[model samples]
Target chain A: MIQLEKIEKTYTAGTVQTPVLKGISFSIHAGEYVAIMGASGTGKSTLMHILGCLDKPTGGRYRLDDIDMVNLDDEALSHLRNGKIGFVFQQFHLLDRATALRNVMLPLIYAKEYPADAHQRAEKALTAVGLAERMSYKPNQLSGGQQQRVAIARALITDPAILLADEPTGNLDSKSGTEVMAIFQRLHRDGRTIILVTHDRNVADHARRVIVLKDGQVAEDRLVAQPRDAESELAAVVDEEVRP
Target chain B: MRTLRIAQEGARALAAHKLRTFFMMAGTIVGIAALTVIMAVGKGTEKKVMKRVNAFGTHAIMITAGGGKGFSPPQAGITTLRLEDAEAIRSQVQGIDVVAPFAVRRDSSTKAGSNQLQTIVMAVGADWHDAWEWYTTDGEPITAEDNSTMARVCLLGTLSASDLFGSQNAIGEDIQIGNVRFKVKGILEPRGTSPMGDEFDRRIVIPLTTGMRRVFNQDYITNIRVTVKDSRQIESIAKEIRQLLHERHHITPPRDDDFAIFSAADIAKMARGISGTLTYLLIALAGLSLLVGGIVLMNILLISVGERTKEIGLRRALGATQGDVFHQFLVESLSVTILGMVAGSVLGWVVSITLARLTQSPVVISWESFALAIGFALVVGVFFGVQPARRAAKLRPVDALR
Candidate 1:
């Protein structure tokens, strides 16, 4: 579960004042699948960064599982990011020198636990992403979709409470994107909390609830009438686009 | 497990840039080598000088008689030091081992079928051989009976025997000295050259009574050679001998004492001082070279840090702590220095042996010098490595990742 009240983020770029996030508030409960949608410069990515504890809010309070995030030091924040939340980036930031298995073992390395079972758990995570045979392949050796799968496996290796994916399918083709969305839908079905960020309406539509941002403010927060399977929903959207 | 993983990652990163790592290491290796060579040269030269000093003989004293003052025409006086004075020193000095009196005169040229050489003939008493630690190569030395009877026998130095007899047996052969014939009773061994480059094995020796009665007809000796029991007591023993000579001469207040005593220990001390100075100079030169090597190491390491900035950033983003980054760079620097130390040690030994052979000087490779050189090189590595490591550690992970 995550909660934020009147969060603001301002960055100073050499004497000029830039406000990326201004007075934004939101909440998400456990086991809920939510997608945040916004146009460029609407602070969705900034909000997601704050929610993932990669960056802190300039003003206001954030609570994750009743623990205040703003009061934690940098090391403690990193610990929270490692132990409680798993992150998947749009660019699939897997370490280039490491194999998929090694990449997935990174969180456990930082947490300093499950050292003996790290390899086994990493293998299991890769298998869950349908990448068991490609565990020895480096990031550069894998396809774009396979690299994203490796990144997702790395995020899920720690079995964190919430999986925060920032535009996870943005770099993949439609078919590979559909497969990634199907994995996310399956994880949601397995009762894992998922917060995804995207500008694509079809990707947002696959979530149980969609929160849209306009001009640094939430424009809509509503549950979908019916949640379709990610593959069929993607096909339906493609069909509608062809008709138009 | 975490530490092992971090170390493995560090090694992998270093392996990725082999050329840079080698270049950085070159600085340390060359520096250590220079230090090793310098230390070897210093120690080798010191040993050579000490050996030369020791060859002059320890705990011995030389008393030369000449140049007295307070006379109307500078008093070209014959200060005839008698056998009585030598006996007085032997009886009165507490640490006296042996006292031998001798007189020298340039006698004559000896010829053997066309080749002739001028030689100094020295007449020595019975204790002279033991006092000077002389050894014979052929025949036998003059005995106490020969000295007392003033026998007309002489010992030819190695060069004298070779020149007169052309490597043939020279014992019992006759040679002309100032129109006087003296038989060669023994041949002296080759004693090598002195510091003044004089061939000591070129002279001739005879009984003191023979030189006084048959050759020079002089009744007194020119010098007295005194051997002491121990080198540590030479200063006091020399003083005792001086006092005894003053009493025998009956000189009041002993102004100049009519003689100058030279202690072999003093000469050894002087030689040691010179050796110390030379060693210091060599160490300084080596230090300068090491300093240059250190600067080279620092320059290369700084350049490496700049070149590997992106790799450093990547490692940091991969969860490397600041201390990890610091240690990684430090290890690279240390490896360079250690390699240089090994190479330098070998190089120093080679150089020392070559110098010893070429100059015919003793080369002493001291373990202390080797350890000091290697230790100095390690210090240089740490001294030059810390700056770059700190700079790398202070780089922010986010900025580096970006």
Candidate 2:
């Protein structure tokens, strides 16, 4: 669960003050699938950064699971980022030198939790994302689709309560984008909370709730019907019936 | 465990860049080599000088008569050093071992067949053998009976025999010294040349009575040589000898006494002073080389830090502590220095040995110098390595990543 009240963020570029996020308020409950959509420079990414605890809000109250995140120090914030939240970026920023399995193990290394079983858990996460066969391959050796799958696996390896993806399908082809959406759909059905930021309406359609932003303010919030479970529908296929 | 993993990673990275590592170690090698060679030369020169000083004989004191002021008329045809003075010194000085009176007559050439050679003929009492521990290679040394009888016999030095006989045995041979024939009794062993390049084994020895009665026909002697029981007591013994000689010569207040006392200990001290100065100069020169090597290390490390910025950024993003980065660089520098030290030590020893052989000088390597050279290199490594390591450690992860 996450909450933000009137969060304001400002940037100083050579003595000139620029405001990115102004008086934005939002909340997401556990196991909820939410999508935040905005055009370029709408502060959607900045909001996502604040929500993930990667950056601090200049003026506001930010609480995650009733704990005040705004009051935590840098070290404590890093701990929270490592232990409570998993991130997936648009470009799938996996370490270039490590194998897919090793990239998944990075968060566990930072948290110092389940160190002895990290390899096993990483393998299981790779299998969950249908990447068990490519676990030993580095990011450069994988395709755009496979690389995104590895990033998703890394996000799920820590078993964090919330998954935050920033433009997860921005760099993928249509087919790979559909596959990535299917994986997200499955993760949501498994009772994990997910918040996805995108500028594409098609990507927003996969979520149960959509929030649109304009000029650093939330313009619309609506509940939409959940997309079909594409993987399970394919799994339910049967041979041609006699009447057909 | 984390440190170990990081160190291993650092090692792998260093190994990947072999040329850079080799270049880093080159400076250290040259520095250590120069230090080792300098120290070896200093130690070897010290030993050679000390050996030369000890060659004059330990605990032996020489008392020479000085030319006094014009007011004190010179004793014409008189020898102030007499048997009485030798007796008094032997009887009064508690630590005196032996005392002998010596007189010398300069002879420019001695004729042996067709060849002529310069020589110094010294007449010494029989106790000279006991006082100086002179050994003969052939016949026996001159005895007390020979002194009493004034025998017409002489001892030839190694060089003197070689000049007279041309490699032939000269034990029973005769040589003419100032129109008088004296039979050669023994040949002395060759003592190497002095610091002044004077050949010590180029003189002849004869009985004191023979030289005075047969050759010069004078009853006076030139100087007295006194040997003490122990080298440590030479100073006290020399003082005693000077006091006794002063009293025997009947000089009051002893204003610039009739004799000057010289001890081997004094010569040894002088030699030590010269060698000490040389050693200091060499150590300073070696220190300069080490300084240069340290500068080279600093330059190379700075360049390396700049070139490896991306690698450092990657490591930081992987959760490495700043202290870990510092240690990695420090270890790399130290490894280079240590490797260079070992190579330099071996090189220095070879150089010292080759120099000793070529120059015919004694080369003595001391353990203390070896240890000091190594320690200096390590200190230089640490001293010059810290700045670069600090620079690498202080780089911010965000800035470096960008």
Candidate 3:
């Protein structure tokens, strides 16, 4: 569970202070699949950063599992991020030198009480993402879609309570994007909380609930009457846009 | 677990950029190697000089003719010192043991078999062996009868004997010096070199009477070497001898006595001065190289930190604390430095050994020198590594990710 009360974020350059997120408030319940839709400068990425504990809110209280996060230092915030949240970026920032399996095992390195079966857990995460056969491959060897899958697997290896994705399918073709959306839908069905930030309407439609941001504030927050199923959409696949 | 992972990640990162890592470590390697060599050579030269000082017995003192400032060694035909002055120093000066007067001729070419070489022909008295603390390795030293009769018997230096005889026994063999053929009565032990860089093994010794009568035909001996009854009394004994020499020669200050007395410490001090300056010069050069090496390491590490901004962001995003990032870079730098120290130690020893062999000098590398070089290298690693590591650690995850 996550909660934020009038979170304010501002960027200053010399004498001028420009507001990016102006008194925005929201909450996402546990095991919910939520999509945040916004254009450039709407501060969706900044909100995602605050939600993932990668950064602190400029002015407001942020609570995750009933613990206040605003006053936490960088080290304590890092521990919170390590244990409670997993992140996936558009660029799929998998280490180029490491194998997918090693990338998946990376989060465990920061875990305070590391699991004895870290390799097996990482392997299971990779298997869940349909990358079991390609775990030994490096990020460069993988397609954009496969690299994103590896990132997801790495994010999932920590068994985090919240999965935060910032435009997960931005770099992939429609076919690979559909495949990634199917995995996200399956994770949601398995009772995992997923928060996806995207500009694409079709990508936002894959989630059950959507929150559209306009001018640094939430314009609309509503649940879909009938959410689009990624698996059913993927079944009508076309072959022309294969990843090159 | 975290520490191990950080170390592994650092190693992987270094291995990814092999050329940069090698260049970074080259400075430390060469720096430490140069330091090792300088330390070895300094100690070795000191030992060699001390051995030379010991060759001239610590209990002995010499009064030489015609020198200013430093002690002037006795050379052939100085004429300022006489045999009577030596007898007076022996009888009148308390703590005096024995006085051996030396009459010398240099550049006396000698031939034995096919070997011909330039050597000094010094005529010394029967007290030479006792006053110099020297004796023959084979056969007998010059006797009182040999000095009294002015016999044509001589002692061959070890190196000169080897040069002429070539493994053949030198005793009883005749060696031709100029037109005279003197029979070798004994061979002196190898004494190597003097502190003044003079080769001790290239000379032959004959009786003082033979040198006065036949060799140079000079009535005056060149120098007098005297041994003291107590080694500790040389300073007082030297003072007494100086007064006696000035009185006997009938010379006063500002009139220039034309003779100088040198205790064993004087020669040792002079030798130490030469070696000390040389050691300081070598160490300065070594230190400069290490400084240059450290600068190179710092610059390259800074560049490396700048280039790895994205990797740093990714690690931070993966829940790495700033301390983790700092520790990672530091470990990377220290790893290379430690590796260089190990490699440099072996490489430096090899280089120093080869250099010593070429220069025909001993090379002494003490354990403390090795330890000091390694300790200095570790300090350099930490000193140069901290700045880059701190810079990397201070990078914000959001900014670095961009």
Candidate 4:
């Protein structure tokens, strides 16, 4: 569960103050699949950073799982992030020198109580992402689509409370993008809470609800009557390629 | 366990880039190797100096009848030194223990039965044995009676006895010293080579009175050996003896005194020749290598930190504390230096053995060198590693991610 009350972020350089997020408020319950959409300069990145607990809002109260993150110190925030939130970056920032399995097991290295079955858990996560045969492969050895899948496996290995994806399909081809979307739809159906942040309308339409930001404020927040089905789109793409 | 895991990550990075790690370790290797060699050579030189000092007699000072720097064999034909000078030093000097005046013949042809050879022969008083701490191992020593009565008995050194008599016993046998036949009374104890690289075991000894009256026919002795009660006061007593000699001989500073005095301390200095300067130069080399090595290690680590900014951000986002990152970098640095220390120690050991074999000198390798090397490695590792670690830990996650 997450809650925001008038979250505001301002950057200061010398004597000049620049406000990035102005009086933004939102709430999302557990197991909810939602998308936050905005163009560049609409404070989309600033809000995403706050939501991921990477940075603090200058003026606001943000509660994730009943703990107000505003008062937590940097060290406590890191532990909180490890325990509650899993992140999938647009660049798929996996360690280049590490194997896919090692990348998935990275979060457990920083866990307060390292699990004894960490290796097995990483294997299962990688298998769930359709990378069972490529567990030992490095990032450079994987394609764009497979690298993204490895990043997803890494994100889910900790079994965090919420999954936050920032432009998860931005760097993939159309076919890989559809496949990634299908995986997300399947996760949503399995009662997992998902927060998808992107500027693409087509990407945001895959979620059950969408919130759009304009000029550092929420301009639209509504439920989609009929969300696009990514599984069928992937099947259609495969069929089109096979027919040729 | 957490720290171990983080340290493992640092080790993995080093393993990944082996050349970079080796470059970081180069300076430490050279510096520690030089340090180890210096310790070995220094300890070996000190041992040699002690041995030579002990051989020359720690409590004795020799006043040779010659005007020259450094210890040399008693200058032949310098007839100014006499038995009265030995008596004056014994009566006038405060710390005098025994004063024995002796004359030396460098090349004297001697014969025993059919064997004949040329060797040095010393004419000494009864106190010479106490003054040199030398005594006959197998037969009677020269006594005051022998010197007083001008006895015809003489002592043969171990080598000289073997040279003149072969396997047969030379004691109670007769030997000729420059056509003067004398009966051998004893075999002197074996003494090793002198500081001047002459064999002390290959010489003969006779009573001073007999030598002056019947043998060489010289009235003046060539050397006065003074043994002091306290070895610590030997240098000052030598100074006093010099002044007494200067006044007795009526010589001033402008006129070079026809005498030279040498103590055990001078022998030590002579034995340690050139090694002191060599040690100082090695110390400078060791210091410079360590200093420059530490600087190079620090600069490379700083550059590595800059290059790994993205990786740092990723680790931070994955819940690594700044302390974890700092610990990782510090571990990386310490590993390089510590590993280099081990390699350098082995290299130094090989070089030390080669030096000992090639130069035929003692090279002592002790545990202290290894301990000191570890100390230096840890110091350089920690000193150079902190700044790069701090810089890495200070990077903000958000900014670093961008």
Q: Which parts of model 4 have CA positions greater than 4 angstroms off?
A: none
TM-score of chain A of each: 0.92, 0.92, 0.96, 0.99
lDDT of 4: 0.91
lDDT (Cα atoms) of all candidates against the true structure: 0.77, 0.77, 0.86, 0.91
Q: Worst lDDT window (10 residues) for model 4 chain B?
A: B70-79
- Judge the docking of candidate 2 as incorrect, acceptable, medium or high: incorrect
Query: Which one is best on TM-score?
Result: 4
Clashing pairs in 2: none
Off by over 4 Å in 3: A238-244, B58-60, B66-75, B87-131, B135-219, B226-282
Residue B153 shift from truth in candidate 3, angstroms: 10
Off by over 4 Å in 1: A1-6, A12-19, A23-37, A40-54, A62-69, A75-87, A90-114, A117-143, A156-244, B58-318, B343-366
Candidate 3 displacement at residue B152 in angstroms: 12
lDDT score, candidate 2: 0.77
Docking class of 1: incorrect
List TM-scores for all candidates, in order.
0.69, 0.62, 0.82, 0.95
Query: What order do candidates take by TM-score, descending?
Result: 4, 3, 1, 2
Q: Model 1 residue A173 lDDT?
A: 92
Candidates 1 and 4, the one with greater DockQ: 4
Best by DockQ: 4
Model 2 ranges with Cα > 4 A deviation:
A1-244, B1-5, B12-27, B62-100, B104-117, B159-176, B187-190, B216-279, B299-309, B343-368, B394-399
Decoy 2 TM-score against native: 0.62
Q: What does candidate 2's lDDT look like per residue over A59-144, in tens digits?
A: 88999978798998655665676667877878677766678997787666555444688899999999998998999998999999
